[model samples]
Target: MLTMKNVTKVFRTEMVETHALRELTLEVKSGEFVAVTGPSGSGKTTFLNIAGLLDDFTGGEYRLDGVEVRQLGDRARSKLRNEKIGFVFQSFNLIPDLNLFDNVDVPLRYRGFTRGERRQRIERALERVGLASRIRHFPAELSGGQQQRVAIARAIAGDPKLLLADEPTGNLDSQMAREVMQLLEELNAGGTVVVIVTHDPEIAARAQRNVHIVDGVASHLDRGPALVSPALRTA
Candidate 1:
């Protein structure tokens, strides 16, 4: 679960100041699938960075998984982020020379897992993403969708409590996008907390909840069909 109360982020320059997030208050419960949608220059990216602990905010409070993040030291924040959060970026962010197995292993190594533990985690993560067979393939050898799946596998290898995806399907075709979305949905169904930031309306609509950001604030929040559907449990 994540909570942001009156969170504000300001970027200062020599002559101008930019507000990336303006007193944004948002909460995501455990095992929920949420989508954040907005146009370019909106605070979507800023919010994601803050939520992922990749960037610092200028004001207000952020409690991730019940720990107050605002006052945590950089070392503490980094450890928490590495242990609890997973990120999937639009760019894939894979190393060119590394095979899929190595790509997923990199983060596990950083987490200081033993070699055997890393191997097991990597294998399971790849299997979860349906990429176990392609673990030896390089990023360049896979299709855009497959590459994205590998990226997702890398993120989930550590069993992160929260998944943050930014423009996950930005470079893929419609079919590929749908495939990726279905994968994410399946993950959420299995109890992963997934939060996606996208500009695509169709993608946003499929999530259990949708939040619209505009001008550094959350402009609209919708519970979407999942909240009212009898078949879906309230997360």
Candidate 2:
């Protein structure tokens, strides 16, 4: 559903040029769950930002669900991003004063859904994440895992075609991480394409495929066993 061909990202300063991605070519098919693993400063974040349309690439091409994003205007890109992509970040990114219901409702509102429709979506997304009972809870009232679930709920509330998660379990304990991963797996089983950027090997290994990045390039790609993946294992 997503394709990047010869994509290169360069950050330029007056004195230095930093290449975040070098001729990166990759494809994520519909319904696939793929993991991206790399060390700090390995361009995983840059790739995610580009994939999410949060930033632009300096060279090459990107096709998201068949539309070429390389030339899309900012307005068009923003609309497409809202309609086609969902993001789950390690920081949760929830508003402290917003309850779970409203947290999930925020993005839907941006999409101009009616109150009834937004409510339905918010409810369903929360239910899917096993947080239906906490819809009234605020961010400060929930644990780290629960807050992250709310973030996930907010992401999927729009029925996005692609889910991009960056270090989704980085802040959670083992039990919470497992719960979140299981939720992602369940979502993938139902046909939403999921791509995760993580440093945790065990989490990356659970995915159907793994992509490893080093020095601004994808150096390894693998499918199958967890032990064979390049990222460092945690327990």
Tens digits of per-residue lDDT for model 2, 114-185: 999999999999998889998898999999999999999998999999999999999998778877888888
Error of 1 at 231 (Å): 21
In candidate 2, position 47 carries an lDDT of 96
Candidate 2 TM-score to native: 0.94
Residue-level lDDT for 170 in candidate 1:
95
Q: What CA root-mean-square deviation does each model show from the true structure?
A: 3.8, 2.7
| lDDT string, candidate 1, 1-235, tens digits | 9999999999999999999999999999999999999999999999999999999999999999999998899889989999999899998898989999999998898899999999999999999889999989899999998899999999999989999999999988877777778778888888989999998776777787898999998965675553342312221
- For candidate 2, list the clashing residue pairs, or say none: none
Single out the weakest 10-residue window by summed lDDT for candidate 2.
226-235
Model 1 weakest lDDT span, ten residues long: 226-235
